[model samples]
Target: MREQYMRTGDGFLIVYSVTDKASFEHVDRFHQLILRVKDRESFPMILVANKVDLMHLRKITREQGKEMATKHNNHRTSGSSPSPVLWGAITPYHHMLSKCHYLIYHLTKRLCELLSTTCYFRAHKIPYIETSAKDPPLNVDKAFHDLVRVIRQQIPEKSQKKKKKTKWRGDRATGTHKLQCVIL
Candidate 1:
């Protein structure tokens, strides 16, 4: 049923509590399931370690989270190229909703920047932000904005690639230009 639900998903955000080792371990299984279900070599995904405010209770260190992300980033399906995996830490200061919003903004920016350097295009970036379950209003708003931005960025690139493919087709018919368009 989960695989069926993910069939139409454009991207995925996998979250785990920083204080829960079991949750963190389950991430790998979820990732594998997604890959097996989608049958895609690479896909946009973000792994977030939440509840960073409970630093003393954190069972998953920041380094461990990063390592996990890196492992997934290097993974490929059916001999395809590696995919990009972005990870982040977020503390949901439920007592102060405003602060949580502010932190989410900063986290979004930083994570997006880090994603820019990866093999994925600017449009393929997956955003990761941390916010408490209690801070519902702001977290939802910010998450929506981030999702919109990612979709917007990808739209132009897809159009441009389409145009390029059209040009390549024209060249092929003319016999004056030799080229190929490989859709991946």
Candidate 2:
């Protein structure tokens, strides 16, 4: 049943209570399951540390939660070159100062984001949001909104006039694959 839900989900909101350490431990499992089910190294997911209102009983520190959320920033980079952000841009003599300034500003911002442990587009890293889960629900709405934005960012535009008919399969008696539906 969990696998079925994972298969159909376009995005995921992985929530763990700050008062429970076991929930925090399960974060890695859920993340891995999402990757495995999607058969992709990266997916649109938001790690939410909920129950932030109970600060006194928080078993997980803010730093710990953030570190867990960012654990996959460098998950896999096999044979990949440096990111464009890290590369210096070439410009004319007059534009050198402006480019340098821009570079400095960008780098500083990135550093701050990483240090603060909350980021969107921080090099394919997952965004982490803290939620209170109380009456007001701190950041709960933002978490969902951010996940939607992430999903939107990942979906490719359909430029072709002709649409492809997507096919899905269901489990068979022998645990083999069989065509379940072909919806146009």
Best by lDDT: 2
Model 1 clash pairs?
none
Question: Which tens-of-lDDT digit does each residue in 3-114 have in candidate 2?
Answer: 7756777777555555555454444556677789989888877655555677688665776544545574522100111111111212222343244334322332121111
TM-score to native of every candidate shown: 0.47, 0.54
| Model 1 per-residue lDDT tens digits across residues 1-184 | 4575457555555544545454444444555666677786545455444555556875546554344335444221110001111222222223222443344333332222212122332223334443334333223334434444544665777688787434443455667764566689
lDDT of 1 at 109: 20
Off by over 4 Å in 2: 66-124, 157-184
Q: Candidate 2 clash total?
A: 0
For model 1, the local distance difference test gives 0.42
Cα RMSD (angstroms) for every candidate in the order listed: 13.2, 18.9
lDDT of 2: 0.50
